[model samples]
Target chain A: MDKTQNNKAWFLVLPVLVIVAFSAVIPLMTVVNYSVNDTFGENEFFWNGLGWFEDMIASDRMHSALGRQVLFSAIILAIEVPLGIFIALHMPKKGFWASFCLVLMALPLLIPFNVVGTIWQIFGRVDIGLLGHGLASIGVDYNYTNDALDAWITIIVMDVWHWTSLVALLCYAGLQSIPQAYYQAARIDQASRWSVFRFIELPKMSGVLLIAVLLRFMDSFMIYTEPFVVTGGGPGNSTTFLSIDLVKMAVGQFDLGPAAAFSIMYFLVILLVSWVFYTVMTTLDNAETK
Target chain B: MMRARSSAIVMTVYLLFLLIPIYWLINMSLKTNTEITSTFTLIPATLTFANYVTILTDPSWYMGYVNSLIYVVLNTLISITVALPAAYAFSRYSFMGDKHLFFWLLTNRMSPPAVFALPFFQLYSSVGLFDTHIAVALAHCLFNVPLAVWILEGFMRGVPKEIDETAYIDGYGFGRFFVRIFMPLIASGIGVAAFFCFMFSWVELLLSRTLTSVYAKSIASTMTRTVSASGMDWGVLAAAGVLTIIPGALVIYFVRNYIAKGFALGRV
Candidate 1:
């Protein structure tokens, strides 16, 4: 759709601009101010230049948290993407069962992050919770509070429970968009089941798959509340992802300069990665059109 | 036949896996604390609504839900009111920096809430809006507005431009056309946008919790801070959790049809 030139359209957009300036821009400026300056009590401040950034860049804490964050995001994508596709593939194509499956699968995505944390917290308790009690009765000796591996598994599983529906739902929508004629053509050609998935469904799903992966990556990278409530980033900083670390630094310890520097860097990394996904998505769109 | 059977089995297993934890939460919510801690009954030995009773009767507890609803409603109304015109502008006209503005708006959606927590805290506090429902609503606009714009733009694009021209030729003014003619055409889009706004605002806790301490505390925060002298109040906590899930579940039921379309950012 070709849009006509209309500078007057800015009037229509002015309201959004005002709200955004207050909501996003002003607060962002504050973050930048805190990053370069040192603050003392009574609103005293001094120029520290790029010293905080240098310190944060050299810090082992940031490195480990980044490492853990990367690993966590990688693990989440690995498990959820494939599993979501599998679930979407098997979902009934339409009618009663399809609606039932969709409504149920979407349940987790709608729950509050903290409630999601609390659900798993209660569900994984060893005393009376079914999962923990069931496992203990079976003699698996599982405890998320005391063990690193258990905490990791619990967070990962909780995330999968909380979010895989999103990917599945997106893929399901993508699958729904495929014309029936394509599938009938494949059947007429006597295509193998694997070929049907690879040559037909896979190509169709690529657009949404990238979206699923990007959303999953961004959300997983910024994850804080669920894991915070479940493990409080504990069993000794084992589940402490980037957001957890930043919150602890800025709010918990009041290390404003470092936290501010960290925030800028954190925002940049997400921006950079998102830019990559955006570029790739546009390239694909262009190729598709061509 | 074999493939059909296999798919059914796989779906059954996966569905069970997705549902069991929720089932467990439900199961715990119906039991007494004594039974919750001491007994291992799959079914509640004696069903109880005492936990739900506790949350409903307690002012401190239920107010959290009210505060959450207030801000969420405010955020949705504000997001849609502003996003409608902006979405229309972007979809219908090419203005200077329109593409850059759209891209910039989206970048905010991807910006981590963790990054803005403290600055938002300061920004709200300085303006004397801290601990107020409006504070959180405005703060949430950072992400929700972009999404509403993106989703609404997609919906608006699907409506042909000839409608606008037809309305103009009929002597319908811009305001009248937009309100009476254009809005009804995209009423479903508005619902979808409002639903997304409500969802993101409701589910978000970091900025909401940070901005409000007591006067306008969120239910999720109330649930998190739920500690009795004895220790964790598992029964009441689970009930609060269940209550939070109910609103979302109801909303999902209403929007089940548009949900996939909305998730695709209004693309069909």
Candidate 2:
């Protein structure tokens, strides 16, 4: 649809602009202000120039947190995308069971982040928790609180349990949109199940798959509350990701200049990914409209 | 028939994996702390509603839910009310910097709540809105409004421009036409946007926790108090966690009918 030129249309947009500016722009500017300046108690300040950014860039702690964050995100994508696709393929196509599956699967997603953390924290406890107690009983040594590998695994599994449904749900919707005619054509050809999934479903799901990947990646990158509640960044900072580290610096230690500098860099990374997401989504929207 | 059976088996195993942890949570919520620590039972040996009783009877505990609901509802209302017009503008009209505006709006959605937490504390504090329900509601608008706009725009774009032209030729003014005609057409879109808004606001802990303290402390914050009081109060903690899941569960249940449809058309 061709849109008319309308300068007056800004009126419709102005409310969003004002609300976002107050909430987004102003706080963002504050972060910038802190990133470039030094401050002491009673709001004393001095010019810091690029010093904080320079420090954060060279900081090994920052590098390690970023490394862990990237690896976590990679692992999440690796597990969730395939698992979600598999689950979607096996899901009941239509009927009471489909509705039942959808409702049950969506339950974890709606729960608050901290509650999710709490659930896992209790569920993974060595003394009382089912997973930990069961593992112990089986002679499999595991303690999420003390072991770094266990902590990592626990967080990863917790994330998978919390979020895989989102991926499956998106792909299910994509699958639903495929006409029965396509399946009938495949049947006439006697296409093997693998071939049907590969040729028909895979290509069809590409659009929503990208959407699933982007959402999962962006969200997994920003994970904080769940991990925080579970491990409190762990036995020895073993589970501390970027957000956890930033919160420790900014709020826990009150290192405003460095934390703010770290935030800018952190945001820049998400912004870059989100820009790609925006471009792809806009292109998809345009294709549909045309 | 064999293939369908295998698929059913696969989904059954997967669903079991999902439900066990939740079941474990419910099981813990129903057991006493002594039972939780002393024994590992698949089912609670002695079912008790003591934890639920403790939370429901405690003002501090139950008010956390109330505070969360108030702000979530407020934020959703504000986000949708503002986003509706903005979405209409972006979906239907070509204007100066509209593309730039849209992209900028999305950046906020992607912005980490951790990044905004400190500055929002300062901003809200300076305005003297600190620790108030309204502050959390306004602070949450940072992400929710942008998301609402994006979702609403997607739904609005599907509405043909012919509807507008027909309404205009019928001598309906823009306001009446928009309110009476355009809105009804995109009502599902509005519902979808509102649902997304509510979900994000409800799940978010960082911003809401930061923007409010006592008098308006959210359930998530209130839950944290259990961690600090002497030893862990496992039963009440589990109960609070279970209660927190209730509202979200109820919300999802109500929207269960439209959830798939909502997601198919909604943006992240």
Candidate 3:
């Protein structure tokens, strides 16, 4: 596959490099500049060294935000991975029903994040929202705007509703790719349904599931718009994940130095995890190829 | 046997749970505001197009649709143009620093949109392109182009090299070979890539909302500003949400198979 002898190919990639440099690299450098320096009105700057990073690392606010973010992502991965697999298992193998279910599943993914937030926002209203009203009528006390647990549940449920389909669809695709001979062989051996799933389907699905995990992890880590629209980080800073807190610092409070440092740290964390994902997936790819 | 039955029951309940909100949206869209707010009617007490009529007739609401379309088209076109060549290079060559460059593109995808919100505003403003459709389009291209390149590269690699050689043997030049042979082979791939580009740009808010104010505002942005002294306007908001689905749904219907394939690959 190597074609390094053909230097002319470099011309094709030159434009993309330029565009990315301007958009990503330059702005990143600006962030780095902001991170180390103090800025005042009229474009004045003062060198602050690693002060912002130190402050952020020591701050209780940052610790709580990071904790909330990690917990949120962990809970998301837990609920979605299992739920999606279950849906994929029960989905009709090949029929009108399969297509029907797939298209329906994709419906949630297409809705805009703000709108998804709005739907759950309205749907969780104690007065009008179906969930809130329905629950209250049954004598359960539930209010997202007031209770932290209720807020967390609403956000988690909102995410599950929106994203589980992606995991399901990916798993379904993996299932579809399984060779019929493998299934026939399992059947010939008089394998139980559980054994068939555990031995054959589970291993086969692992490849796509790895991808699902990576995507979900990256997405859940960066999630801001839905939670923002739904809760506005609410009833105090209870639901303010890292991204929400960063925005509040940068825009709301205009603390550019701390926000910039936090963003760099945020980017680094994502980069580290994404690299781990890439390395793992590629290693698996190599194993499969071998 | 009992476990299977219970599993089936669990999955069915899950499906209904997923579908009810969508049904509620459509249900609310059809109902009058009074009906939506007052009655907890499972079905609309009376079907009405008042919400749709209001949104369509109002310049502000209708203009949001137009602005969104303009930026989406611009984003798609720019993404495809830049991405095609980059994808071609990535797929066909092992040029200097190719692996590094490929990974670098992915880093753009991983960076949180919020991180870039302030810097993008400053970057665009310095260039005198603030609050324009082109600004949003260009900002989106930052992520879309990389995604397009990665997805398209995967598809392009699947095409046989023999065709390129055959085209060359027949005296076809690079341009002809790429247009006549390479393009048809990867048409479905490009279609899927284009759809992803459109979908991401369409749904994006943090960047889009930050970049534009008046001329290039999107439907999603309009939904945000809908909250006023008149109250939250749930009926109109639901209608807008339902209407926004039209473009994505239409795209999905046409390329349902490709969309499914694209999703399986995690292209978007």
Candidate 1 local lDDT, B166-224, one digit each (tens): 99999999999999999999988898899999999999989998999999999978877
Misplaced by over 4 Å in model 1 are A286-290, B228-230
Q: In model 1, which residue pairs have backbone atoms overlapping below 3 Å?
A: none
**Better model by lDDT: candidate 1 vs candidate 3:** 1
Q: For candidate 3, lDDT tens digit of each residue in A1-290? A: 44445667889988888887888887898899999999887899999999999999999999999999999999999999998998888877766766767777787887778888888887888887888999999999999999988999999999999999989888888888889999999999999999999999999999889888987998899999999988999868889998999899988898999999999999999989988888887688668757
Q: Which residue segments of model 2 deviate by more than 4 Å?
A: B265-268
- Score residue B248 of candidate 1 by CA lDDT: 91
Would you list the C-alpha lDDT of every candidate in the order shown?
Answer: 0.91, 0.90, 0.86
lDDT at B242, model 1: 88
Report the lDDT of model 3 for residue B5: 81
Candidate 3 chain A: worst 10 consecutive residues by lDDT? Answer: A1-10
Looking at candidate 2 chain A, the ten consecutive residues that score lowest on lDDT are: A281-290
**Model 3 C-alpha lDDT per residue in residues B25-81, reported as the tens digit of each score:** 888888888887788988888988999999999989999999988999999998888
Q: In candidate 2, residue A127 scores what lDDT? A: 91
Per-candidate interface DockQ score: 0.79, 0.74, 0.58
